[model samples]
Target: MSFSAFRILAEALTGHGGWKPMWREPEPQARYDIVIIGGGGHGLATAYYLAKEHGLTNIAVVEKGWLGSGNIGRNTTIIRSNYMLPGNEPFYELSMRLWEGLEQDFNYNAMVSQRGVLNLCHSDAQRDAYVRRGNAMIMAGADAELLDTDGVRAMYPFLDFANARFPVKGGLLQRRGGTARHDAVAWGYARGADMRGVDILQNCEVTGFLIEDGQCNGVETTRGTIRAGKVASCAAGSSSRVLEKAGLRLPIESHVLQAFVSEGLKPVIDGVITFGAGHFYISQSDKGGLVFGGDIDGYNSYAQRGNLPVIEDVCEGGMALMPAIGRARLLRAWGGVMDMSMDGSPIIDRTPVNNLFINAGWCYGGFKATPASGWCYAHLLATGKPHPVAAQMRLDRFERGLAIDEKGAGPQPNLH
Candidate 1:
C-alpha cells in the first residue's frame, strides 16, 4: 500500500482498516537469473537496483535468517561521506547524494536525517587534518565546514572543553552527515525489490557454491540447489566464511563492534559527535535515547558480544568528551560483526572464478555506503564493468600496490 497524508487520513476516518504488510514472504525458486547471498542492507539494495535501475527482475536474495536480522539492525545508524583519499572520496560522495534522494526514490520513509556530523579535534595537528579532510569532502561535492571552539560550543556546550588530556580545539562539520532508521532502509529496499519481482528467500541458507572449471554457476542452499547465471556475495561479516565455500581465501578479518544506548529522556543532543582523542562517537536517537559506540574488540570472531575492557574504554572516552553523560545509565548494548579488510577499504570486483562477483570488506562504512555500494555492484553485474566512482575498489589492489588506507590503519584489521 502506498503511504501518504491522504492515505493516513482515510485510514483514520475508516477506523484504520486499510493497512498492509510492507513486503511479501516468498519461497525460493528452483532457479533465478541472479542469486545474491546475504539479506543485509547491501544485498537488499543490490537487488533493488538490479530491478529498478537495470531492469533485471529475475533475482533472488537468499538469507539464512529473517530480513534485517543481521548487522543492518544492530548498527548505530550513522551515515557520512567524509574521506580524504582519492579512491574513496568520490564513491562515498555518490552515497551521500543517493542518501539525499533515497526516500523519494524508494517511496518509503527511511528517516534519512542529515542533521550534521561533527568530528571534534583535540589538537592543532588534528584540526589541520580535519581541514584537509573537509577540503577533500567539498572537492568531492559533499558539504563540509570547519568549526572553531566557539562554533562547536554553540552546537554542543556540554562537552569538556578544558580537559588537558584531550581539550576540544575545533571540529569538522559535514552538514549532510547524520543517521537514519537502519531497519527501515532494509525494509524499504526489500519492498521496492519485491514489487519488481525479485524474490527474497529468507531462511534459505547457502551451504555451498556450485562451481566447476573455475566458474561459479549457482549455489547449494538449505532448501535446494538453485542455479543462476551469475552469483554475488554481499554477506558483510560472514564474507570470509561464505566465500571460503568457493575455495577463495580473502584478506579480511571479522571483529565485533559494540554499540550502546541510554534510557530515553528529553531531547539533548542536536547532531552526531565524535571524540578525536579516542574512538567513541555518539548521537541522540529520535526517541530521545543517546546512541553511541566505540572501537572494535581487539580480536577476531563471529560472536555478537564484547568484553568489559572495551566497554570501560568506550565509557572513558564518552566521559572525557562529555562529562555530563558520565552519570547516564546505559540501557542496552549490542554488537555487530565487522568485515575489516587489510587496508581498511572495501572490495567490489569480479573474483578469479568467472561469473562470481564479490562485495565485501566494508569495515565501519557499510551503513553509510549502502546506496552507492548497491548502485556500483548492480552496475558491475549488469555491464561487466566497474562503476566509475567505485573503479578503484578492485580485489587486486593489493597486488598492484595501491592500498587505499583512508584511516592510516595499515594492514592490521584490528587497528582499522
Candidate 2:
C-alpha cells in the first residue's frame, strides 16, 4: 500500500492521536497458561502470536509501565535483517518477513516503509565485512546489494561523499529493510492480543519469581501474585534485574542508547543510512523529522541517560555523511537502556528453571527483531524446544564456548 493509504488506515483504527490505552486492569487471575513480562513490542508480539498462531489465548502480558514505554518506544525504529552471523541471520530474516505482513495481520496501519537501509563502509576491512554480510543475506534469500562510491552518491546525493576523516567508499544495501511506526507496532500487537482474550496487565511490576522446587511457577508483582504455567521475559534493559530476582545471572550489561531528531523539515532522506566507520545512522520519519542514533555509552549504567560526546559524535558522523543535515537543528534527544549481551546476538532459550524462558539480550536491535523474536519465543514457550531459526541463541552457548560472535570480535559490549 502507499504510505498515505497506510497512514490513513492506521490513523483510522488507532485514532488520529496515535496509540492510546484501549484496556484497563483486569483482576490478577490465579493462573495463566503463559505470562510474559514487559509489555513492549516483543512481549506484545509474543502474546499476539501465542494467541493467533498457537491458539493459546489464556495469556497475560504483565508490564511494569504502560505499553511501549520501554526500548520499543525509544529505538529509532529501523528494521532490517542484514546480519552476518549464522545464529542471527535466520531469526532476523523471520522478523523482516513478519514486518512485511504486520499491517495485514493486525489490521492496524504500522506505516512500515521498506525504503531500504544502507550500511556504509569507510575502510577496506569494513568493505570486506559488508561483502560478507551481503553474501550471507543473499544466501538466506534476503535482498542485499553492494554499492560502490558512485552508486552511493547516486542513491544519496546529500552525503558529503568526500570527507578526509571518513571517506565514503561503498555500502551494503538491504532493499527489504527500512523503518516502521514504533508506537503503532506496540498498539497493533496489544489491540490484536487483547481482542483475542489475552489479558494485558499494565503498571504491574514483577518483583520476584515464584520458584517452587527449583521450578518457576509464577511471579510476585507489585500489584499482586499471578501464577502461570510458563513465563517468558522480554524485558530488554531490565532483563538482568528480572533474572537476578530468579537467581539467574546472564552475561548481559545494561547500557544506554541515545537517539536524536531534528526539527521537522521537508522530506529529504527517503531511506535509512548507517555509517559503519563512525557508528551512526539516520532516517527521515513520516512526520518529516530526521530520526538518527549512534553507539551506546561505553560504560554500564541503569540510568537511561547518555553523555554529550555520543551526541556530538553522531552529529559529526551525520555531517560527514549528509552535510545538509548540519544546518538542521536538532529538536529533541532521548535515551533508552539496552541489554548488551556478551555476544552481539539475542538469547531466546528455555531456562533451566523449568517453565521459565528468556528472549532478551537483543542489544540495540530488539525493536526491529520484535516480530520474529516473538514468533520464535512463542514456539519455544509452547513446545519447550528451540526453533531451528533461534537454536543458536541457546543459553548454554556461553558455557559451551559456541558463541555466535557476529562482529568477529570476542564477546564485548563496545565492539558491538
Candidate 3:
C-alpha cells in the first residue's frame, strides 16, 4: 500500500486519529517521575513501555534535536534476530517477537515488513559460521533456514551464481527479519507515550547531570532544570558527550555510518541480502528504492561526512549480486553518527549512580531491538534491577573482563 494510505489506516487503527504536532515547546520546570535523555527510538520506546506496561506515567523524553531526527531517524532500518553468541541471541529473539506484534499493540503500522534477511557465506568457514548462527536461532526457538547455493539462486534469481571471486555458497536466512519505517517507529512510540501523559521535550539539549552524593537526581538542560526520581540515557551517537558531561567515561567510540539509495524502479529484490565478504547489504524498499549501506567510516568523528571508499565498496557489492542495479542512478546519500561499544553489543543496565540507568551502545542493531530494549530498560528503571533479558549487557561487563563480544570480530570498536 502507498505510504499515504498506510498513514491514514495507521491513524484510524491507533485512535491517535492523525498527525498534528511537528514541534512542541518544552516546559521549563516540570518534575517527572522518570527523565529519559536523548529522544531516539530507545528513549521513546522506554518511555512508552514505562507508561503502558508498568503504569509509570510521569515521564519525559528530552531530545537535543527534533523527535526522530537523530540516529534513530538516520539508520538503514533493517530488523533481524540472527545472532551468534549466547548473550545476544535470546535478547534479539525477544526483540523479534516484539516486532511481530508492534502494529497490533501500538495500533499504528510502522510498515514492518518481514521480507526476510539472508546472511551470505562465501567459503567453507563462513558457511560453517552460518550453520552455527542458524543452529543458534533454532535453539532459541526462532525461525531460520540454512540455504545452499542452489537454494540461494532459487530464491534470488538475479544473483550471479557463478562468480568466482565471491561465489554464492549458502546463507542463513531468518524469515522473520526485515525492515520497518524508522521515522514511524519514533512517532508511534511518541504518540503512544504522549497519549499516556508522558512529556516529550524536543530541541531541549541536556547540558549536564544533576548528581548529588554520587547519584543522579535530575538534569540541567537548555530550557531549565527538571528533577526526576530516575534518569536513563538512550543517547546514541552523542552518548559519550552526555556521559562526559555527567563526569563519567565510557568505552564507546563515536563514528559515522553512511547509507545510499538508488532511484526507484520496479521492485526486484524481495528480501534483505547481506554479502558478508563484501561488507555490504541491499534491500528494495516498498517505494521501489534500492536502499543500501555498508561498514562504518573507520574513524572517530562526530562529522557525518561519508568517505568514498565505503560507498564505492557498497555499490560494487550491489553490482556483484544484481548487475541490473548498476544502471540505476544514485539519488541521495546520508550519514549518522553511531556510538559503537567496545564489545559491539548494547549496554542496558543501571549506572554506578544509584538512580541513573543506561541503554546505549546498540551499535547498528539498535533499531531492530527497540521494543525489547525499552521493555528491559523500563524493568531496570522500575525495579532497580537488570531484567533477565538484558542481564548480560551490564555496564561493568567490560571492566569486569566479561564482555559479550557477539560478532567475535574482536575488541576493536568498528568491527561491527
Report per-prediction Cα RMSD to one decimal.
0.8, 3.2, 3.2
Question: Given candidate 1, what's the lDDT at residue 402?
Answer: 93
lDDT of 1 by residue, 180-257 (tens): 999999999999999999999999999999998999999999989999999999999999999999999998999999
Which regions of candidate 1 deviate over 4 angstroms?
none
**What overall lDDT goes with each candidate model?**
0.93, 0.89, 0.86
lDDT of 1 at 276: 96
The candidate that wins on lDDT is 1
For model 3, the stretches where C-alpha displacement exceeds 4 angstroms are 1-26
Q: Estimate each model's TM-score.
A: 0.99, 0.94, 0.94
Model 1: lDDT of residue 415: 90
Per-residue lDDT of model 3, residues 1-416, tens digit only: 11356687788899965667633454755688899998889999999999999999888999988888887788888999998777888999999999999987877779999999998888999998888878988898788998998899898988877777888888899999999999999988888888888889988899988899998999999989999899889998888899888777887998889999889989788889998778778898889998999888889979876888888888888878778778899998988888899999999987787788778888877888999998899889888878887899988897699898877776799887
lDDT score, candidate 1, position 142: 86
Candidate numbers, best lDDT first, in rank order: 1, 2, 3
RMSD of 3: 3.2
